[model samples]
Target: MRAYNETWIENKNVVSQAERWHRRSLLTDDQLTAVRKAYPVGFQTMNGFLEIGLFIFTIIATGGVFLLFVELLSIDDSSIFGLYCLLFGIGLAILNNVLIRRRQFYRNGVDNALVMATTALMVGGFNSQFLDDGSLWQWCLVALPLLAAVVWYYGDTLITFIALAVLYTCLFDLTLEASFGRTLLPFVGMVVSGLLMQATRMIRQRAYYDDAVSLTQWVALAMLLVSVNYYVVRETNWLLIRSTLRRSGVMSPPEIDLPWLFWLLTVGLPIGYLWQGFVRKNRMLIILGVLGVAAAVATIRYYVGILPLNVHLTLCGLFLIGIAVGGIRYLRSSRYGFTDVPDEDSPDEFLISSDVITAAQVAAGTSGHDQHDNVKFGGGKFGGGGAGGGYN
Candidate 1:
């Protein structure tokens, strides 16, 4: 009876150990999956919190600035205080971003969102001309370039550069010499936009390309320079065309006869078309480019003496349709190429095939460049492979 009891106890001990091992294996698998799911969610939540916090702070800061201006409306000395609020607000913004970054999150999403929000706020504030007390929003203007430099230094985004360019252009509107020949702003903006596009192509980073999303920014910059040219040229006789348009056939803006704004529209549309054409390098793009240049010339002729709006609009419509056709052709041409084994002496360093590397040990005896490279990493061939050849 004692021997039977001893045998039963031995059997129970073995079964308990097996059960414990089985539970541990199952728990380990569950924990792994839970960790994988939680990591991404945790990062996203952190990013969302920072974005919301920064946006709220900017609004509150702007409000405080507005109130300060209202309070100091009577004194010439109040400009100094308004400047103080602007500087302090900008400082707080920079500090907030630094703090938000210290908390862990998906780094790319956090950086992109914060930079985008900040730039959008700057542009909106510029558009609103936030400080209307005849101060030219001077403090905001001065801080903008500094903000741009910081963006360039550490932001690692294409939008950051584009925002910098726009800020540079905005200086024109803020300047005392806007009435003079200060078309430098828009010209520089266009150049910067093109350079950024090239940088995007070479770097293959999406963040940089996002900055070129400013269609209005491009147009506004162009108009500033064009307006300068119109004033210098002084072709006021074009106003007679408005009467002709009214009498003959088409409805147009009441101020359409003015050469200043109309000439800008004339130059802008063609420049946009030509610029896209040259950048893209398609045959159709080249043709559209010619048409755009021609249209601009035609518009100028109509305004000056000879042609008319209806004819101009017709040619413009045809040019636009051609632009769409060219775009589709360009898209179709950009297909991905096949992955191939790279030439040994070629400049390219190819990524290895995962499948070949996985089963590499079994076929280690087979002489291949890949096996030689694998062995270098201490992944030895299966046969007589020491620590250097066998799986570590």
Candidate 2:
């Protein structure tokens, strides 16, 4: 908080917030007390309750504005749409800049969501401007570098995930469309991307990479799981030759039985993820592994309906229960990764806790990091890691 003028002192509210920021760092104690003493009374009550509602309000406000345009303007021209997207992008970028100028970047709870929404606007503008042809959405791939550069430069942690998601989507579509980029390539790509995020974070941890690392982990995991799940359901044998011929109008896509590899991966990959997750204490992998197991079973049951649903479900429930009981019994005197993890403040596990201040934690809690860094707290090796640690 740079003091731009002497009024910064007369304006005790900002001083108090600045002190709060200092406390969050957990650096000094007496300095905080002295600052509070100088600026006591007429406490600047931040409308945090109102701030909570602001997210919903921001979303609705954006939609309302767009809706008004659609309803009142009767603008159906594509050029007009392009103009609107460009104008909206410019407007949102300016608005975010305004907030930054007001020093509300980290202060306002709604800033992140607002900025992410703006990202969509910017991407829309890019699409309207560049993707004028009505071709496969694959053209969106060109926007990847542009959006990635913008997000990297903009320095919004939340936007990183969106950018990465777009990147992955393009990769997936391009791979699926092409004959060569099939089978295990996309799956490997996703898993590698996730692992790289973990590895990079470990090597270059810092305060700036917090949200980007946390959010992208989930997105990468999702891509991995979806790719693996698709492999379980379908066969990719001779895809290149087949797709090549089909593209040249030589043959149509053939109907074929599920490959042996599909079943092998369906059962094997899930167990592998589960085992790795348990041993490595990687919750993301464990979760994907557990869900993978269920999906594998469901896929099997969907294709093979020899038994009644009730009977299959009963057997599954009993099997899961047996595993739970045996596992719990085996580890009763010991410990498991998830067994000792403390509960987070947010029920929405997707959200960052420190970024979110519950009424209780807000009133009673002292300043501290959101405990998002896994190395600083409880987490698996691949989980959200501690930042600010220098790379070796």
Query: Against the hidden reference, what TM-scores do the models get?
Result: 0.36, 0.63
Lowest-sum lDDT 10-residue window in model 2? 383-392
Which pairs of residues clash in candidate 1, taking residues 3 or more apart in a chain or in different chains?
A: 158-208, 379-389, 380-389, 380-390
Tens digits of per-residue lDDT, candidate 2, 1-392, equal: 22112232233433435444663675375665555455442222244455468666777887788768767888788777867877776786677666655643442445555666666776776677667884444555766676666555454555665567666666666666665556545455656676856765675644344455655665565455545543322434345457676777856444334466556766787788789888997866766677667766776666665878778878878998998888767765656445532333223331543344333224433222223233321223222211111010
Supply candidate 2's per-residue lDDT for 7: 33
**Top model number, lDDT:** 2
Q: List the residue pairs that clash in candidate 2.
A: 205-388
Q: In model 1, which runs have C-alpha deviations exceeding 4 angstroms?
A: 1-91, 102-141, 153-298, 301-315, 318-392
Superposition TM-score, candidate 1 onto the true structure: 0.36
Evaluate model 2: give its TM-score.
0.63
Give all candidate RMSDs, comma-separated. 22.2, 9.7
